[model samples]
Target chain A: MARGSTRPTSRDVAQAAGVSQAAVSLVLGDKWRGRVSQATAERVREAARDLGYRPNLAARNLRLGRTRTVLLVVPALTTEFFAGVYTGAARIAAEHGFGVVLYPSPEGIGPARDPFASAQSALDGVIASSMAADALTAIRGEALPLVMLDSDPDGSLGAATVNLDIADGIRQAAEHLLSLGHRRFLHLAADVPSWTFEVRARELAARLDEVPGTTVRTARSPISIEGAVTAAQAALAAPGDRPTAVICDDDQLAAGTYKAARRLGLRIPDDLSVTGVDDLALATAMDPELTTVHLNAELFGERGMRALLAVLEGRAPESGDIPVRLVLRGSTARAG
Target chain B: MARGSTRPTSRDVAQAAGVSQAAVSLVLGDKWRGRVSQATAERVREAARDLGYRPNLAARNLRLGRTRTVLLVVPALTTEFFAGVYTGAARIAAEHGFGVVLYPSPEGIGPARDPFASAQSALDGVIASSMAADALTAIRGEALPLVMLDSDPDGSLGAATVNLDIADGIRQAAEHLLSLGHRRFLHLAADVPSWTFEVRARELAARLDEVPGTTVRTARSPISIEGAVTAAQAALAAPGDRPTAVICDDDQLAAGTYKAARRLGLRIPDDLSVTGVDDLALATAMDPELTTVHLNAELFGERGMRALLAVLEGRAPESGDIPVRLVLRGSTARAG
Candidate 1:
C-alpha cells in the first residue's frame, strides 16, 4: 500500500503487480493491447487504481516535446463578450485536440512578466487580444507563434492578425443614428487605449464628417456602468441641446448611458436615442433593449484560434476581417 | 541560421557558437559565471538570439519537478465577482512565485474531463469554486492538492475548504427588508444546485421564519439577467399578495427583477423594494441602485489561495468563513 501523501509512481505499481516498468507504462498508456496479455493488463490496472498512480504529465510533456497547450492572453475577463470569445476558442482548440490556457493580461493581478511563466503551461503558441498590447512586448520577446486579435495588421510584429470589422460596425452605428435625424451625437467611448476602440472612434468620426449639420461630442469613461454614468452625466450636463443620440463603444457603456439618461429624466426615444457596440447581455436587459452592433464574439474566438493553428502549422493564416452587423433594437428611434 | 518553423534546440545554438552542449547549457542557464569566461556567455546568448531559440519549458519543468503553477477552476468567468476573485488570487499567487491558470468549468466549452488536461498546465495545486462542484469528481480522481471555495465544510472530501459567510449575507438582506416593515418577501434564488446558492436559500427561509408576519416566496432563476427577468416576471404575475421586498441571490438576478418590475409598471422602493447579493457593477447601473450584500470577492480569492498554499505545505488551512456586509442603497425602502 502507498504510504503518506507522496504520490505512488508507476514503478511502485509495476513492483506491486510483479511486472516490468516498461509493461506498466505500456498498459497505463493504453499501448499494451497487443503487447501485454489481458490478464497482465487487468493486474496492472487494479494495482494502479489501488495505488492511485497518475502518469506524470511533466514527464509526458517532456517526452512529447509539445504540451499541445496554447495561451490566450486577453486584456480582461470581466465581461460576457470575452466569455463568448473564450468559449469559441476553447471549442475549436478542443476539436483540434489542443487545450487553451487563459491569461487575463495581469492588469492588477501582478507584475507583467513572462505570461508563459505565469500560465505555468508549456505552450505551443499564443493568441493574444491586442487590447492587451502592453503584454505584447513581453510576448514578442519569446519566439512563440503568436496571433494578435483586433490589432493593426500593418504594425503587427510578423504575427498573424484576426480582427472584427470594428470600423464597419461603427460606420453602421453612425449611419443608423444619422438616418434617424440624430444630427447631434454623443460618442460615449471606452477609455481603454486599444486599437479596437480606436477603430470605433476613427470610423465614427469619419462617417459623421460626411453628413452635413452633424456635431459629434465625445465623453470618455473607463469601461464600467458607473464610470459611464458619471462621464455621461457630466458630458450631458451642458445647457442647450444635449446630444439627442449617444453612440457607446460597447454595451456596458451603453447600459451606463441608460442610467445617465434616467438620472436626467430624459426618456428613451422621446428625448434621447442611444446605440452601443457589442450586443452583450446587458444590451437586452435594459427596459428598452439596446440598438447595437452584434460582433460575433464566438466566431471571433474561433477565427483567432484558427489563425493561431495556421501559424503553428507554418501555413499563411486565412485573412480578411470577420464581418460584424448592426442590430436594430428598441433603444433607438427618430430623434425628437 | 535555423531554417523552417521548427524551434532551434540548444544543440543548434551550441553548434552555431562552436561550443560543447554542456557549455551552451551552462552559459544559457546562467550557471557559467565562474566556470566560463564572460565572452563565452555573451557568444552563447548572441547565438541563441540569432537562432531565435527559446529554452524548452517542458524539459525545465521536468527537471524542477514543480511548475509553480496553480489552476483556478471557476464556474464561469462572465461575472465581475469571479473576475475580482481571480484578481485577488493572482495577486497572492504572484507574491508566492506561483502562476494561476483559469479553467471555466466546461459548460459549453467541452466535455467534463481532467481540468489539468483542459488547463494544459502541469499544476502544483487547484483552487476550485464549489459552484463548479460537477468538475470536482474529475479533480479528486487526481492527486493534486486542492482547496475548495464556498464548499460545505461538513461534506468536504477531506480537502481544505474556503467559504464566504453566505448565510450571514442572506440573514443581513432579510433582516434589512424585515426592518423596513416588509412582511411579504420574495427570495430570488439562483437555480443552480451549489452549496453557495443552497446556503442562500436555506438561510433566507430560516431567517424569515423567525419573524411572525414575514412570508417569504421563492423564485429560482438560472444566473443570468434574462433568466431572472423571465422567472421574476412569471412569479410576480401570480395574483394576490405580491412580494413588496425581493431579495435576489445575486446582483444580476436583482437586475432582472428590476426589468420585471419595470414591465409590470411597479416602481422601485415605492411599490416594491429589492435586494441583491455580490454588489456587482450592475447594482448601481440601475436607476435606484441595488441594496445588496457585499461579498469581498477579492478577499475570498486571496483566502482560497492562502488555504491552498497551506495545504501544499502540509500546514492546516485557516479556519472560519470570510465575513460579508450589506451595503444600503436606494432600491430598498420602508414598506409603503
Candidate 2:
C-alpha cells in the first residue's frame, strides 16, 4: 500500500457486513462468547479481514481500564537530548502498542509542584528523566510503576532505572585529554546537581588525580552558552597556572566556552582544547565544531519507553546502561 | 517562598481544625450544600485561611467533573516552532489554573491510536496546530471543544481558528523585497497541502503580481533543511533568469536554501537574498541570521488554548488572526 492508503476501522467492516459494529469488535477483541452468534461472528471477522479494520483504540482503552499510556517527566524542552530520548522511547512503546506523553516539568523553568496534572490521561506507568528531581517530590511514593532515566543507578528507590554509560564517556574523554599530554584540566560542570553531570565531574577528577603530576580545576555554570562563558572566564582568570584542556558537561556549555575562549584570545585546540557532552546539532553547527559524547537521545527515549511497557506487562526491565560514545571533532586536540 | 515554598492544602487545614477533609474541600470549593453545618463550614474556612490552604487542582477538577486540561495536538516535535507555541499556550493556560497536555497523534511514535489516550486525563478542550490535520481527522468529530492554530481561516470546520497573519507576513516580505529593488523572487514554499502554505504561495504571488514586471518562481520543498536544499538547488539551476530573492515558508527551509545558495557560489543578501517565516532559534543561530517573518507561534498557541478554553466555557472565541511581524536580520539587504 502507498502512503496514507488505509486505516479501516471495525465500524467500516460492520457497515459493509450489515452487522452491528459491536459484533465486529467482539470477534476481533476475541471476547465473542454467548453475546455474538457463531455465524454472525464469522461474517464480521471475514468482513474485518477484507477491510483491514483495527478496533477503535479509545473505545478499547476505555473498556480495558488502562490506556497503555506512559507519562515521561523531564526537566526542560530546549535541548534535543531529552527530545531524542522521547523519540526513541516512543518508538519502542509504539512497537508494543503503548503511547508516551512527555511532560517537561515546569520546575526547571520555575516551580512546578505536580507535572502529572498536565498529563491528563491516567497512566499505566511512568518514565522520568532524573534531571527534574524537584518535580519528583510529588511523584515519589505513588503506586504508579516507575522507571528512572540517567539517575543514580544504585539509588533505585524500588523503581527501575535506565542510564547512559556516562562513566565510559567520561573515561573516554579523560583518557583522550590525558593522552594529549595535558597536565592541567578544567572541568566546567553544570551547576545543577544531576547524577549524569555528577558522574562526569567525579570520574574526571578521579582520572586526573591518578596522573601524579596532573592538576584539575572545577567551575560551575548553568547549562547554557552565556553561563558557560562566564564560568569559563572566571575559571581561566585565576592568578595561577591556566588549564590546558577544558571539559564541558554539555554542547551548549561548550558553545559558551567557545565564545569565552575567543574573548580570552584563546583559539580552540590551539590555546585550549575543549570537549563537551551531548553531541547536539549545535556542536556541529559551531564554527570549529566540537568534540563531544554522542548521547543517542532517540535510542534512549526508545529504550525508556520500552522499559516502561515491559514493567506494565509484568516483565522485568532490560538490564545494563545505554552506552554513550565520544564523537571526535575539531574542537579537541593536543595541548599547545 | 523562594524556589520550594511550602504549599498548604485544604486537608492540612481541616486536620488542624479537627474536621473532616470533606468539610475543608466543601468550604474552600464553596459547595457545602447542607453537607456541613454552617458553624462547621465557618470553622473550616477559618482554618483554611489560617493555614493558607489552597485546594489541589485534581480534587477541584474532579469535583467539577470537568478536567480543565487542554490537549495541544502539534504535527511534530522535530522543530522549535511548535515548541514555542506550546510554551506560549502553556503559559496562558497556567494563569487560569488549566494544564496543557501535548497530544502526539502524528508522532505515532507510540502505538496508541489516539494521542489523548496517553495523556491519561480526558481533556475539556483541544488546540491543534496545522501539522496535525491528518491526526486531527480522527479527533475532529468528537464532542470535545477544539481550536485550530495556523489552519484555514475560512475552512475551520466550524471550530474557532487562531491563525498567524500569514498572508500579511507574506505580503510584508514581498513588499520588503520589492522595496529593496528585488523584482524577481523565488517562493520557496512548503510542499505540504496544508492551507497555511497555500496562503503563503497565493499571497506571495498576489502581492508580487501587484507590481509591474515583478516575477515569482515557485519551488516546493518539504519543511526540512535537506528538502529545501534539493528544491532550492533545482529552482536556482533553472536556465537563463534567476530570482534575486528567495522567500521560504519556515526557518529550517530557509537554512536549507542558504546551503543551496552556497553550493551555487551565491552569497546571502549580495548574490541572493532569502527570507523565512517562523523566526525559530535557528534563525539567529544561522551563519547570517535569517531575515524572516516573526510568526508568533507562542501567541498562536496561547490564543488557541485560550480559544479552546473559551469554547469549553461556552463563550465565543477571540476573533481575527493573531498578528505576525517581519524580523529583518542580516539575510536580506537592498539589491545591489
Q: What TM-score goes with each of the models?
A: 0.91, 0.80
lDDT of 1 by residue, A168-231 (tens): 9989888888888889989999898888999999998899898888898899999888789899
DockQ (C-alpha) of model 1? 0.58
Candidate 1, residue B106: lDDT: 76
Model 1: lDDT of residue B190: 91
Docking class of 2: incorrect
The whole-model lDDT of each prediction reads 0.87, 0.78
> Residue-wise lDDT of candidate 2 within B183-287, one digit each (tens)?
988888888778889888888878877789987788889877767888999999898689899999988789888878888988888989899988766676565
Residue A54 lDDT (model 1): 74
Tens digit of per-residue lDDT, candidate 1, span B1-336: 336557788998999999988999999777997999999889989999998787776777778887888889999977888888898999999999899988888767766856866776678899999888678888877767899999888888798999999899889888888888999988888988789998988888888888887787888899999899999998888778998999899999998999999999999989999999998877887768889999898999999999999998989989999999999999999999
- Alpha carbon lDDT at B330, candidate 2: 90
Q: Which stretches of candidate 1 lie over 4 Å from their true place?
A: A1-53, A239-241, B1-55
